[model samples]
Target: MPGNYVVVVVLSSLAALVLLLPPLFAAVDDGMRSGGKCTNSCGNVGFEYPFGVEDGCYRGGGFNLTCNHTYQSPRLFLGDGSVQVLDISVPHGWALINNTGMVFNSTETRVVLNRTWDQLVGGPYSLSGSNKIALVGCNARVDLRARVKVKHGGRGGDDDTGSNLISSCTAVCPLDLEDMTPVFAIGSGGSSAACSGVGCCQADINLDIPSSYTIQIHNLQELGGSISPTDLVFISKEEFSYTNDMAFGNNIPQALPALLDWYISSDPSECTYESAPDCLSANSFCHAYDLGYKCHCSDGYQGNPYIRGGCHDIDECKSPQDYSCYGNCNNTPGSHICDCPRGYERNASTPNGCKDIDECGHRETYQCYGECINFPGGFDCLCYHGTDGDPRKEGGCLPVKHHLSARDLGLFIGLGVGSGTILLLIAVGAPFLSRKMKDRMRIAVEVARALTYLHSAATVPLIAKVSDFGASRYVPINQTEVTNAVQGTIGYLDPEYYYTGHLMDKSDVFSFGVLVIELLTRKRPTYRTDQGDSLVLHFASLLRQGQLVGILDPQVLTEGGGEVMEVALLAGMCTRMTGQDRPTMREVEMGLENLRVSKKLASHDTASSSLVSQMAEHRMIATGDMEESSIQYSMEK
Candidate 1:
């Protein structure tokens, strides 16, 4: 009862294991037999469909097997009792069977041993290519002859030869003939006991077996005066080793292990691209072998392809060693998708299927104009070397200037005075401006030095003629120049210059203010609303209402940020009705410079909480300078 219980448990466990396997491999087609439950095992070997012990259980007569109960233990044989089956590998389409060595006496010049196929004749079985013929004798040469099945390229099908010699080997005693002993017994040096042409030899079958073969042993030299020693030959698996019993041709095994190839169908062209009825399992296909056709599961599926729905999708995600996925793995019907995690990207070169994105390395997308420090998933674009501002924009990172300079004052003066001012002001103010105008004042100074030398060439105290003389009017720093008539571009003309009939430096400053409004709003000086109001008037009204951003260019709002608003406010001060009410060009430039410095300091504050606290007091002083010095238009004349 205990043994029965153990058997029940083992059977149940095996069933469960089969169920857990992919449908293609389930039970190895064990349950495919019809007419009541068929026996799946005989002795220790278990088999499946296409091979059975009873009628209606196997595919055909060729697949029928017999379980012999006459012995103490049950033994499985092919059809009747000729060959005993040891193991059957359904997936590999091979079977391990027992074979016997042939023994014959040779007195004449040659002796021949022949065996015919019986139980396995006309069946889907043949001695596999993995078997070799071995001969054990002295002073004899053995040769194997068989009818091998050869497939024809044309429609003629297979061509079976009448008799073809496949392989041959010779054996001889390496000692005196009178000794009448094997090579090992003679203690000959450099002679091995293995099947190496000394007393024993081996040869490959080298061709497909057709259930029958012949072995001819020719006695090269007779060892005795009459009958020679018995010669033994074995057609066994290629892995079989020769021993003393085989060398002396005695105590030979009744059954030596040999591999036999098997197939599902004898039809060579049954499984073509268009049709494969023999492969009944879903997700399975038929492939042709040298002799017949075999069924195999399609890619990503496994199991017995010879049975209906016996092939199931392989869970590739479960086997990481075989189907590797480094990130979030999603298994599908016949395949799987591996998606990298957030902030990561797929990399074919990496085994993990993903690699971290170097955000800093991609400057175009990340836009870091400063020191870029890369980390896992993300990166830091800190203002490098004490410079401060957003590193994510053009000219966003800027050098930290502690004090306003005369050049900075002059640049903004130009910005508020002419169309060229914006370029000149930005040259010294921020990197967002034109690179051509950077250090414009310095370049002008150099040109002036060169001109000074040019003027020295004039004999009459270097009388220098200034270009664009019409654009210049003599006016003292403290006084304005009176003109006979008001003449200027309509949109850029100074109102006070026409009323006072005078050309003052403030006239140029007024025109510069119009240019600033043009830059910020992306509107021409002549641009006007349906109400016939100029861009300057509309801009000034919006600035007074603290709605300066409403009319600002969208691009300026994005790139300029808070700096745009400060620039708009400065433009308003320059366009004031009274020339004296508007700050001087020098004061305007200084204010713009102060705004740049403030912006830089603000960026520095964001680096760390400790730094923010440390710079808080200085930031207030900088902010106070911007408010008091930059846009605080003085009314004093």
Candidate 2:
């Protein structure tokens, strides 16, 4: 029994060790438990967790730094020996690198720079979007090209090679010194101090640059020959604005500060709570970045995410200015609360939290017209109705102007009499006007339908060319030949055709539109008001001002509902300035047909619903009578 118990204890110990070994090994491998043994600095440059110069200090090779002490001061570099790392920012995962210089041709007329794709492959660095390509010359042309290999399935399986992508920009100098004066000022030695196309131009690189790319500059041939031979072209990380003249004197810096994006190389799918590498810090999480994963501290916490117990909660109340809490602030684990005192409210636009309520804003709460005074936590209204005086003073408002003046009394009487006269006229003439409008609308519809058939369905299609007679003549099908001269009446003729002497189907459509407007207003096209305004012009003006409702006949508005609005819109479209803007006869016919169909379906649905409701009422009434009779018969028996 003793031997069996010993064997059981040994097996249990082995199981426990097996269960605990993974996390222990992971913590050591990720440098979280390294206890600051790693070299954290190279010269003046400092390093954070996950980045170090020695083994067992960094998460992986991409995070490794090479400290070169060849110069007077030690310098840091990436895996690529040629690229010197200037600075590393852990919070933003960005690294500033001094890029290589551009190569100028022997003639200095052309400049070229090449970047290889292999530099970024399997590396933690990628090109960022904040880079710009600049060309400094009076007339310069720049061409950027890249050769990208396309993978068939996004994985590194089958691939298509040598797809060239190209982008180009051209900058031209002003015609003369006078033309350049507004953009750039001439300095003491006749030098311009602007880079905004007067002598230099810059364009942003909107798309991501492939690992392998080439930038080429060419001298643009202009009327005054090629630009200055001292021209230069290069890529920059910072945006360029017209500040100083750097184009002529070759003052542009050779190396520009360029940003490189960095991320962890670990796969997100393989990361787990028990096996996460360098991501075991409290209050931190892992997220996918580019082709791998990166670690981030949780919301309300900030610290080095790769170290154990690194993330800490932020006490927002301690920094009132940062959080814009002007009132009493209460601190929480990761946030704060700002509370306003009694009778005060929060100010949405100000950093100060509480403000006195503007009682005048709430008109119903304090109905005062003279004055509304606001205090620190409250407000007061100081005027009474039907009085005028200084509201801030006590008993300020007193009764005044209670009696009406002679002019006021006269105005009131005039308004009443005018209103009564207008109402009386409307009451007496409404029925007669209604009858006349119905007749006009019927005639207009018939005319429109006839025109639609003549233009689209007749054996010999008709075209309206006569001006005096309201008649149309037949023309051969699909015959769009222009007539010799315009032969239409002066008032109704399409202005375009009248001046150009060109006849088209749209000419007729224009005349029909005018007729529709005439019918709606119950007025002749030649009719004018006392102001001598033509009916057609007046109708167009009202429509343009969105006053169609005001100008529409009262009878038409009463009976037509939305249909009148649609017709009015159609009329406006047909009478557009250009004949080509008019709708074809077939389209006009279809529009009217659709409107008729919709109206018929709506009417049928309403009738069916009414019938059903009537039948239901009758059934209820009959059932009631039957029940009464049954009860009466039972009593008699």
Residue-level lDDT of model 2, residues 434-532, one tens digit each, is 234444554444445555655665555666432333334446686853665556554466777766777777876777767677667756556666666
- The local distance difference test score of model 2 is 0.54
Tens-place lDDT per residue, model 1, 150-211, is 67677967776566687788877566588753453233433335777766778777676655
What is the C-alpha local distance difference test score of each model? 0.56, 0.54
Residue 122 in candidate 2, Cα distance off native in Å = 1.4
Any runs in candidate 1 off by more than 4 Å, and if so which?
1-36, 68-74, 101-106, 118-120, 148-161, 176-192, 223-229, 249-251, 323-330, 336-357, 365-372, 376-637
TM-score of each: 0.49, 0.44
Clashes per prediction? 10, 3
Top lDDT model: 1
